[model samples]
Target: MSTWNRTGPVVVEVDGSAEYLRIVDYASAEALRCGAELVLVAPYSAHASVSPMMPGYSPKAPAERADDALRAAVAHVRHRDGYATELAAVAGEGSRVRVLAHAARKARMLVVGRSRSRGPQRLMHAHTNLTLASRAGCPVVVVPASWKPCLMDRKVAVGIDGTALSAEALEFAFGTAAGREGDLTVVHAGLPAEHAWNDEDPDHSWISRADHLLSETLAPWTGRFPNVRVTRFLSSRQPAAALVHESSEVGLVVVGSHTGALPVDPVARRSVAAMTCPVAIVPHHVTATDHERISAAPRRPARRAGRSDVLTP
Candidate 1:
């Protein structure tokens, strides 16, 4: 039997870095507010730092350090929040990323700090955040150090353009919303007005059909998630621009890596580069078995474009 709960459990992943703790604090507070349980993974390991002299030591040191540090972090969290959190050192691993992916099986959402804290003038590292979101199984929430968790409708957002790959994204998003007890927004963008009803054009029907398809695609999920509010919006701008624009108000945005027979939107792929929030590129084949949640996940295959982005308070 799988340890994974079909109901929903929000998982917050951390290295317990100062930056990550801030994120955990923010997310935990939100979870508490939403009446959701927080599962904290304080890996006893640390990623091996770059050192030619200690190449082999890099892999093992992080596990031990992460385990110890995570326990301390959990203790602090318990004292501050009035209850102890479920903490895991994440037993075995091929790598930190790989371990987390496996643990994600039982989680509705995976939370990770986008990057370490930086000076006021510093910017976030797109590569790190992208890798975490792209590879994670569940919808990955990239919490920033400066992020202020507020009680708003701006919960998780999933982008779907009527593709099977989108079904994967929606399934993950719906499960995450249920876990968080948060609202969800479905955003779709079509061509400019000229292409909206130009039935003569080869792809005109593609744009025209979005409204109905968007409604149908989400129909089954609505009844299953009455408490998790859903909103559908259509834009006449380019897919990437509109999606990125919608992300400005969302805590996270979920998009299909590639949907059905169509390749993932290049702009949406790149739109993540400039998105105001974290974007999880949900893959089509993510699944896990029993008890412990998988921590690291398979890396998102190389995308055609490589722009990524993040922000802070």
Candidate 2:
């Protein structure tokens, strides 16, 4: 039998980097907050990349390197102010996404480190994150390698359109904010071209419409999490840019992505690349196991149904 639980441990990727302690730190804090176990995963190939052109390429066997990485992460967690949230480390042999997805089959959430690589390298890295998020069957958090503990760590923001796509993301954002005892910022960015201006009202009308949309979307969550303060922001800026801007002031930016066949929207792709803080990519759909868990949770109150000026970018 698999160790997969509907509300399982928080699984994080351990990439064998000397700086990966930061990733471990963030994940461990999240695990502690949710009272979930923290499982560190390191994926490596058994075969070493040996080449005749460069015989010096052999550093160490991939398995050995993975073991070393897991050991270091375990030690880091153990030494962190006497951190004691149930922890486990696994070294799996396979591709990155495959191993991590399997490890987090039905986990509470999956966390991974984001690469700062630019140009083509950055695109490739983003694709991997997207795939992982889709396959993990749980929320996936991509934390920047440069992330450090800061005052903004408690601040969380999420992007939403007037569609079901953002429903799951909203839930994650509100839950996270509640856990941190922090405020939640809800951003709705609309393109000027998408709306028609009238002589009766121009800028103010669009702003009002956006505000109304956010109010409707957030009604259920606000009632459920009465303690979480919310800030509604409406802007004419591009969706991706708007999210990236908010990321500078927030610890986490949550965005919804389509699961299965559909690719993540362009806004999510761009935000992940430019965000200054960690980004949580929540899929719109959930696995059967997750449905079982959610079915038992408190049901959210229904909201007034109607579409507004929220663009589905």
Candidate 3:
């Protein structure tokens, strides 16, 4: 679990792309809802990207591009009644992942935009987001590039793996559902290969075990978020596929990612790429119990000032 204070600012990336305004809108609303400051950061490279054919043409410097992005983002936020939330914009000089991770080091959460790329591009994009989430030390909300406000935005879903790994994710899901004043759906997906079952028996032990796990994992959160209606779904499909299916019906999907020096898990990578709705990747520390539950071995351990500094103004 993240040790940073949840009351910190809500940091968001401002890339000045087609989807940037929408991302800013989402971040602004989250900051307003949480009563925290909304921070906009634009990361730029040191050098300019000049094309060979455009050698005679002078393209804007990276610093200038970053400033422009931040300016536009600030205007967009203010235009949407974001005056109530404290706002700050920073133009940082570095890689996107580095700057964003630094900016959100102590943030309540980091909000970023997901590209609409497919195939290898999609996988690479998802990998970058997951990398940022792992290093961010806070939850990372990856909003779909095509996302727009709708009635379904009120519904939220979370995937639990029937272990302590999902503990922090459950907390975030319940809180988000309560905040939206919507329903929460808990999905637990188990593959047949992972479980042993009798072909003749109609009642599989895995089903009962999954049910108990969901109930036990959700007990405290359910009591805390009484107003958020909860629904349980146990599926035999792949974990990532199950969450992606749920994403179509909900506004947000929350899933946990193990934090360590190892590579990002396939489940999180696939779900984030495939989900149609916004996905929140909550990073939690992998515990000994998690290893025992999954029969896995232990793993090794493992943003955002503008111009190398984080400016408030």
Candidate 4:
């Protein structure tokens, strides 16, 4: 049966790299937090087209090799953490990206391990991570290999663009922060205002506009999640750079994919290459209906554009 019919597990991709075991650890913790099952999938490519008369052919089957790897990964997880959550192992066929993307269709989230590589090697790895983040039905959390198990920072950072998609990112960020009892930082980056008056004091006027937009965007979520502490950050840097800088201090960074409208390659590449924390790429499609419903509600009074007041929730 297709795993898609069920909806209780957090799927993780495990491979040859020992770093993947760390991914299992993070995914397990996330599964525990969500009260869901953890599934470890090891995907192997089948080389059926290879000629049998090759000079250096091995007799062992590809499925057998894949099964062995999957079993070892499961054993490693059991040895390290003695994880208590319900777990399963599957030896899937096809590319790792394809298998994981298929599994994510019914999962709470798809977790994958990323390691630092250079040049074309880096691009290859990024292609897989990017594919998963952009195509997965659920959120994709790309955890860096260098991440260590430490005391939770209790902070979640999210990038906001004042778009409907950003609202989805905010919802995920708020839920994550609330669950972890963490503070949420909403970062918005944009160019200076076009008007000369506002341009002279962009920090005052431009920042105020960004703050108002963020507040208005988060107003409904603030009501829904009354306990989540939120702080607003305004920057003139590029979105990717701003979020990446914020990622350094935050436990987790959340971003919206905007139904694939927003380019995720830059963040995905940087996250794998150097991010200190796991990055959650939450696509906006899943929350589109909710956004529409919220939009149909009574509108709030439009806040004045040039107020120096900061937004607090």
Q: Which candidate is the best by TM-score?
A: 3
Score candidate 3 by TM-score against the native.
Answer: 0.87
TM-score winner between candidates 2 and 4: 2
Candidate 1 TM-score, C-alpha based = 0.66
Greater-lDDT candidate between 1 and 4: 4
Candidate 1 residue-wise lDDT, 20-128, digit = tens = 6776776576466546667666533344667788766544465676666567667667777866444343444356566666666666566766544343212334434
Cα error, residue 100 of model 2, in Å, equals 0.6
TM-score of each: 0.66, 0.85, 0.87, 0.78
Q: What is the lDDT of residue 141 in candidate 1?
A: 63
**TM-score: the better of candidates 1 and 2:** 2
List per-candidate RMSD values in Å. Answer: 8.7, 7.5, 7.7, 7.8
What TM-score does model 2 achieve against the real structure?
0.85
Per-residue C-alpha lDDT of model 4 across residues 121-144, encoded as one tens digit per residue = 865775557557667767788888
Q: After the best TM-score superposition of candidate 3, give how far the Cα of residue 138 lies from its true spot, in angstroms.
A: 0.8
Q: Write the per-residue lDDT of candidate 2 for residues 47-97, one digit (tens) a residue.
A: 787778987676788999999999999998899836668999999999988
- Candidate 2: stretches off by over 4 Å: 1-6, 51-58, 81-83, 191-204, 286-313
> Candidate 4: which stretches are off by over 4 Å?
1-7, 48-60, 80-83, 119-124, 191-204, 258-274, 286-313
Q: Estimate the overall C-alpha local distance difference test score of candidate 1.
A: 0.59
C-alpha positional error of residue 63 in candidate 1 after TM-score superposition, expressed in Å? 5.0
lDDT of candidate 4 at residue 104, scale 0 to 100: 75
